[model samples]
Target: MADLYKEIGNDSDYGSINDNSSAQTEDPQTSAPSPSPMTRHQYIVFCGIALAYFADLTSFSLIAPFYPIEAKEKDLSPVMIGFVFSVFSLVQFLSSPIFGKLLPYVGAKFMFLAGSWVAAGSNLIFGVLDELEPGTQFLVFCLVTRCVGALGASASVTAATAIIAHTFPDRTGQMMGLLELFCGVGLMVGPALGGLLYSVGGYKLPFMVLGAADTLVVIINIFLIRSSEGMESKTKGSMLAVAKIPAVWVIALTCGVASTGMGFLDPTMSPHLKEQYNLSPVFISLVYILSGSAYAIATPLWGYLSDKKRITRTLIVFGLTGGGVCFLFLGPTPLFPQVPTDQVWTVIVTVGLGSLLLGCAIVPTFIDLLNTAKWYGLPDDISTQGIVSGVFNSFFSLGAFVGPTVGGVLQQHYGFPWASTMVGFMFVIMAILIVLFGFWEYQCGKGRRRPPNNDLTRQVSVNYFGSEIDDTEENRGLLS
Candidate 1:
């Protein structure tokens, strides 16, 4: 156990074991310099990113509580409703990479502001959808507006991620966590606010109110965010090159798996609670709020731990394993026949705990991916960060697209209990694979000799061979 922790902790980036011979050929520009203290300018940039993230997520989730009911009133089937929701993620998944590739050429500030404006416009257009009579026209409008809104979201989110990474390279994990905290708050606030607005007016009220607020956020940021210099990279980043690395594949899967768990719950969880526990809609909303709150509250702590303690891999493994246990109880799966699924407390506790762990698992992934790619050979520039951010968003959006569609089908055919169990099994399987991979890495490290100097080369040797290399003559001997 001690050896495993040492292996994981010493090489938190999970540097590609097979690519150790390539390290000497790596671009020295890829090496991250020590991070300086935050300046007033950085704080301003962070605030802008945080507000933008909050608005993006709030608008993204705002329709959740009432959109299905409105769609049904328009005579759309459940599958059609699901399509409307899934299209957002689908467009985001496709467009994120494109925007990422363009970031170096166009600049992050331009993409961020432009995307915000587009999203705000889409929201305003969607507000008037109620005016159209229910039928094919309504469905067509829904899909078009959702696709446009998703494009805007993809641009803004991708740009924001790149900006934060470049602006605070040393604290990438912590900043990403803070942004996710805003996202969780947005998720919590969107439904409650949407339900409130829906009560006061009708279908159009929520979109109108939120759309106007989103525009307001954009206007504020226009002045608050300055164009950062030195953000554009000389070399174009290749997503294909980054994707080819095995370490990146592991990180992407970790991200996708975590998102899949969350996405699956969106459509199925409400209905399951209503059917099994007989909870009111308000109570159901509270349950979601509980989960979001847990996620929001725990995200920052996980980020702090990752940055301060360098436990990125450990958090990912722990989050997945712990989340799997929570999911089993969340359904009070038949596996645990004694646990009462009928009780409201069971749903609340398990979902909250599950989300808490989910936050821990996901918050460090961006930084982990960034460092891993750089360690393997990707340039450490704005271009590389943009590409990495794009790939990360694409995987996350892919999971979102797949999860709800599959979750809805599984819930329809099997029961929520089984559906939930399947998700649990996915988490456990991934966790086990990570552990096995770590053991294999440890075994490989055992064959290398430790060096005496314990300097920079020592760190490099540990990263590559799980052992140290002397800074002097031994370095040449090992390299040759």
Candidate 2:
């Protein structure tokens, strides 16, 4: 197993012992031995990351069920409420890159623990906002706490990605997918739990309970997460270097567009169901649970397929295309006048299917970004991992920021159908762009001289993109 790890670069399907020799010789320090199978310590770290993801998302989503109602009582308008939700993503979008750049300096373990602690503190503060008399003071405090929470979420998430990539270099996609599964569970659990707690003890109880639980998870992680001392890169990585890669830009765009669909639904979906189907808040919560369940259940499978089958690109195209079609029918939009929007079953089915496909589309993005960056000549080091993770989170958060802000205004003015249609269009367009990019890659590979046996650069490209474009100056210029 150790020999296999060294010989194959832990990428058995594409790289052979001969092929990896150059990579190892070029940067032996960075090409440390890979762990082919999970170690006991690795399992502990994986579990800690999973729990941290679960806790972070649970806290993020818990407010969904009842925050708006309380906000209404405090005289906040729909747009203002939307802003409150968007602000979290806004902070994450702006702060994630900063955190990524800093990950090497602070260390992943410290960032993870400190971030979880900050998030926990914010949750406790958010619980108390309800105690303030309804006015500007209440709204101001609400935004401030949410911003703080977003900062913590960004820091923790960036660190978590770096940790995962470092710990499981070979299984980044599968691990990310599994982590997302926990996130999906959190998404499902948060609202339902929040609604229940809200019923039993009102707003304060939900935050107090979940926040306390999150703090506990952080405490356990303090012992479980090992320091990333030796894993740190000798040189700091540049976010600008990662951003300059054309393929990275494509992945980032796809992530942002896919996330927009989710963000669009968050602020708009419940009201749409309420207005059209006359469903109660409890039933609406169930709708979200159904969607989250589908998303949670499908993510791990997608991740496994991505890593094992090397179908990352295929999955993204399929997921985006299918998800777009689902969204088209989600509102049973104006474009699909034949479909009935008034039926409860239509809403449930579309939302569930859409969420599932979106999960498939999103699960492979982190690994895809990592692979693409490596293919483009970025060193596979902690700094590179940190920058890639930051880029992924930054773009996803940008979509999250844009989605709710725009969706709220669109739904308020134009109605849910049009808003849904707009998101559907974006998905389909992105899928088309990805397909076109693949075609161009194929064209570039055509008629090029076959690379030599030990050509690590060409082998890396073949491993990732299923193409054999030569690593020539001309080809690099063309790609860039």
Spell out the clash pairs found in candidate 1: none
lDDT of 1 by residue, 232-254 (tens): 77666776656655667887888
**Clashes in candidate 2: how many?**
0
Clashing pairs in 2: none
Tens digit per residue, CA lDDT, model 2, 19-59: 32323412212322333888898899999999999988988
**C-alpha lDDT score of every prediction, in listed order:** 0.80, 0.80
Worst 10 residues of 2 by lDDT: 445-454
TM-score of 1: 0.86
Please state the error at residue 310 of candidate 1 in Å.
Answer: 1.5
CA RMSD of all predictions: 7.4, 6.6
Residue 119: error of model 2 in Å? 0.7
